[model samples]
Target: MAKVSIVDVAKAAEVSVSTVSLVLRKKGHISQATTDRVHQAMAELGYVYNQSAANLRSQKSNVIGLLFDRLESDFSIKILKCLIRELEKQGFIAMVKTGALTADALTLAVNELKTQHVAGIILVAAGSVDGGLTPVLSAAELPYQVMANQGGLGMSDLIVCDHYSDSLTLTRFLLDLGHVSTVLFGGELHDPVFGERANGYLEAYRERGIPARKAHIIYADTDLTGQRQRLEAALRSDNSISALLCHSPAAAMIGAQSVLKLGYGVGKDFILSQQKYVTCFQEVDRLSDGVMDLSYILLPLEEMAHHAVRQLLQRLDTPEPLPGRAFSGALIR
Candidate 1:
């Protein structure tokens, strides 16, 4: 009924508590025989050392929280992998959680991680222009970094792909392909990141002396199915549409499939380019002909993680405060 402790192991092994401690830690010049006895006694008594409790005494939990917008999203998985590898290198274990897109969900997740006594948190914000989490994270006092999302607040470190600029680049590339009519498929324009990319799309058209038509700019839904329906309808209505630029890479694959289903070839009929971050796949096929390479932007996730972890550790080690930092991304062909 009682929890097993080191004292019980020491008593059973006929050794002092100090000797048992030294043996358990593999320190203090304890003899091999005494170490063996301590181990056997521990096994016999079913004693488990409370490492978490010990870690609390040292004021470092060696735990980091990874919060994502959607667990199943492809970009989320890519960023998570990079974050895990970086955290492991720093000698910290990463605990991952997802579906923290809403305000209540984000608040609840932060509370849960706090209960676990995590040292820092890496949040993959949904980049909703219609919403914000800066106030919530600031209130929670959780040292955090924003990943796969744009940075704005001073409370956290921000690592984001330059969505606005890259969108313009992709759109211009489509124009350069001699495609007169262009359509930009995007998610919520209320999200900051999406909003930025949408602005880029509009700016590209305006610069090229093209009229900014709302009908040409289709704001897709957040998920894949919604985006597929929206894109399919847009393309089906106007078969004259020759170029398509999308902001969601995961949804872009679906768009490609939709294009195929409509008896249109991707590289030939519709020049396609995804404006958002892409995961490193084993072999990426070029979606559009005449393009020098696969049309996509690649976020530097490892570098982002390195900056985030460094900031988090600095906050943990010293008492100095840091302003919110922003990291930009690059376009990969």
Candidate 2:
């Protein structure tokens, strides 16, 4: 059988060849209904678009680059999956590159992506290394957007969950529940992501005219044993601390375990609250049965990824600067 061609798709869809070409290239002001018809015709005819040939003809690539500091965590994996799916739906292919979170490594990755002729890039900075990476990305002068927990120093468009609002809401909820001495657990002091959350936690106390204790803010250690030790010490130091507000699900699990090890019931003796990514709830559930008893702020990772892809595509189409997008997490008690 002859390979299906654009002419055949045009004939089947009852549109001109040029219209089919426009639809294939995602150009022109084609109506949604017409686009759907063209897609259906191509599907029925088993048409496979030759992206390489199209790129050569038009001098515009349909490949997007995804640069990541790391992809080790479940949150990163979920974001990766969402980004791939969304990019594919927009008629673009993804080229993923991961490396050490440093200026030199990021420069190498961006240069490599440029050599491949990627249309644009989406940088995923999970760690607090964006301070160094932002300068490299800006120097590259490529069309790129950032999808991370914290915004970088550059003027690039960003997509991030509203950590400050969510943290403030969660902390206030715990305080309203009569846990005035609730302690915040996890996160580094210098990291921007954690800094926003810490400010929110403190803001909640300020709103209520309650003085926040310096000792109540506990930064997480690299290991679980160290975190457990710190939490145990905090609880022992103040009998009035009847609640724990953790920065993430992992922190919450450790806090719960520590409370139990100290002969305190999780729900009865001490309240547990945490900010959880919606996508990774199942993993957390399997890791700790006590998670169900805790109050939560749910981060919508899929929604954030969808917005990031949409914004990046828009940025590619029109080289104008777009405002950064921030989404708030949902509260669950």
Best lDDT among the predictions, by candidate number: 2
Tens digits of per-residue lDDT for model 1, 247-273: 565445665667666766665334354
Candidate 1, residue 95: Cα displacement in angstroms equals 2.2
> How well does candidate 2 match the true structure in TM-score terms?
0.73
- Model 2: per-residue Cα lDDT over 220-247, one tens digit each: 8688788889888988887677777777
Model 1 C-alpha RMSD vs. true structure (Å) is 11.0
Candidate 1 runs further than 4 Å off: 1-59, 98-117, 128-143, 148-157, 186-193, 213-215, 221-240, 261-264, 268-293, 317-321
Cα error of candidate 2 at position 54, Å? 12
Name model 2 segments beyond 4 Å from true: 1-59, 73-75, 100-104, 128-142, 268-283, 286-291
* TM-scores, all models, native as reference: 0.60, 0.73
lDDT of 1: 0.66
**Index of the highest-TM-score prediction:** 2
lDDT of 1 at 124: 79
